[model samples]
Target chain A: MKRISCDSSSIIALSSNCLMWVLDKFETEFIIPFYVKKEIIDTPLKGKKYSFEAMKHGLLIGNTLKVKETDPILRDKIIKLSNTLLSHKGKPIEIIQYGEADAIALAIKEDVSTLLVDEKNTRLLIEDLEGLKKVIERRTGRDFEINKTSAQELNKLLKGLKIIRSTELIAVAIKRGFFDWPYPRADIVKNALTALKFSGCAISSKEINETVDILTQTH
Target chain B: MKFALDALNFFKKTDTKLLRNLSDKILIDGFIEKNNELINLSIVVHSLSKICEKDYYKKDGVYWKTFVDKIQANLEEVASDKAQVIILEKIIVELDNHFGRYKNNVLHRSKIRKGSTLYAWGVSLTLASQMVKIPEIELMKQIGRTKIVDEEAQIKTISERLKDAEEIL
Candidate 1:
């Protein structure tokens, strides 16, 4: 079976807006790293407010998503390289947690090419070196330098690893007739995409308008 | 030196609004300096500022002291530099004890709230989470609730990402 790997945050984004059900609509198997399972299902289950949302995700894990064990050695290397890839004030900026790193490692280990991730930093670190440099500068009001060795090593590992957010997933799902939009209003797809953004999918207004344009125009 | 004293003074005064400047300072300095201690201090001040400003009773003197007095005692014992991280960790325990019902990691909510405020200030999600040591997932959820991403430009076009999703499916 074909598979796509996703981290916990994407699931959190999907579950936040009632879009987790769309996972079942695809022929592809949605797999998560073991650590990703702990992040989405085990850890959040203990919190008061998030416990209920966590339980909902637990059901999706059991019924729809498959859990796969990742290579710990590979996962750690990714974490170490990624956290040290960018530098600030003569110190390496630590980015990408074990959960995000483990998710990427599982994809590499399993030969999965597409990763569904909603966190902006992980995507930026993987796809945009200069964009990330500007973010660091803008946020800190200071300049930062990058460690080229770590950057090359990280790029070698993440080469050809395609990243997409939950917003895009919903757009694709809607394009393919996700069951949720039945008896749809003209604005349903746009609304659904917008809802995912407001629910923390890290989508921009321009992207949302553009997505709405493509999806609605073709619909 | 000055930050620690201001934190102490912020606690001493009835006005929680003073936290805005202190928080702005830490947010900028914490990222530029790449300092964990400043980041920890940032989380504490930002969380207290939000909590006090939003909640009615927390703004009042006696009720405010209930929270501040405890942070103050811990502040008194430590050197100014170390006081920030210590007080942050202590507040997690204090809040858990105060609520008395939820399991641990409840303060994940509070920690991520402060983390999102950093995101609003134009820091990347990973940088903000890394600074405060919160998970990306937790911080992402807070970002959704706050909808701060609406302000920033999207790095990739939506149509381009749609193709990626379609290819995977």
Candidate 2:
């Protein structure tokens, strides 16, 4: 079974779409860092409505979703790497939260197949080199010349890691007969993906439409 | 420091009207006592920085840069004391760097702790409301942080709670 580590945003996105239960249908083992669990559980209890819903969904998943603690040394290393990777114009950017750092560290330490996240910024950092450069340019207002060493370092850290969003999970669930709605197959897939988008999956309309088409055709 | 504390107290109350009145008092008194506009600006900046944990500048860097530039230009013309001017310039640079760090971190999608993010946002909203002399509640609603609850839809009868409890039990 593939191992998947999830950040809080993806969990919240899944919860918002009422699709958190679909994780049980997969053979994949889901893990969340201790901090990510705290993010889902504690923050919401403080009156964040969205977080509260996510916590409820988390509880519904129960033991299927493993809450793991990243090795402290590995967690610190990943945090340092994340901060270094995000710096622009030779200045360190302190943006990665403890939960995100812990999630990434756990994935790396445990050799998880994928890290599930729904934040646009994080996705770009891991997947889009050009997009990362554009973000640097926007933030610093300077031409971001990608240095060779930095590129190599980032590639090394992120190599062999797959980053997925909640939309993809929903698509998979649709393919696996997890959703038993009476709607047309195409409509069901489209609506499910679209709901994930509106629920903060950071997926574009075009992507959702394309995914819907692909899922229907594949079926 | 007293000014900063007073500003924070007013911010916590979400009293934009009182903050505006206080700003007027600070400006007048600061100018009369110190003959320095930087002092007045510093009071406001100190309060804003303290409350927002300096997240306000990060959220809107260009606006803050422009604001600091305007103050710097004004200080050059009005203040004859070079030492005071230099000190104010350092403050401006520090504020600029503070916001710059935030902007970079966010762009990189580096995680910021949930609690800090919420606190920063809350403080930023309060400071913006006070700066604009608008009610914080109005700003909160405008920002989609607060919503008009439908009383009828939200009402849960005692029977419903009992039924839920019974089902759980």
> What DockQ do the predictions score, one after another?
0.46, 0.04
Model 2 deviation from the true structure expressed as Cα RMSD, one decimal place:
15.9
lDDT of 1 by residue, A17-39 (tens): 87787888888889998878887
Per-residue lDDT of B138 in model 2? 28
Against the unseen true structure, what C-alpha lDDT does each candidate score?
A: 0.72, 0.53
lDDT of 2 by residue, A1-219 (tens): 677888876776676556777888787788988877766676556554345564575675557689877877877765565545534345544435466667878988898757887655455556665565564454334453555555577668778667777777777677678888888878987887666655545555656667677767778
Give the top-scoring candidate (TM-score). 1
Instruction: Name the regions of candidate 2 deviating beyond 4 angstroms.
Output: A48-58, A86-89, A138-140, A145-150, B1-169
Range of the 10 consecutive residues with the lowest summed lDDT in candidate 1 chain A: A177-186
| Candidate 2 C-alpha lDDT tens digits along B63-93 | 6656555544434433444334334434545
What DockQ number belongs to candidate 2?
0.04
- Candidate 1: list runs displaced more than 4 Å: A180-185, B10-18, B27-37, B47-74, B79-110, B118-138, B145-147
Clashing pairs in 1: A200-B144
Q: What TM-scores do the predictions have? A: 0.83, 0.56
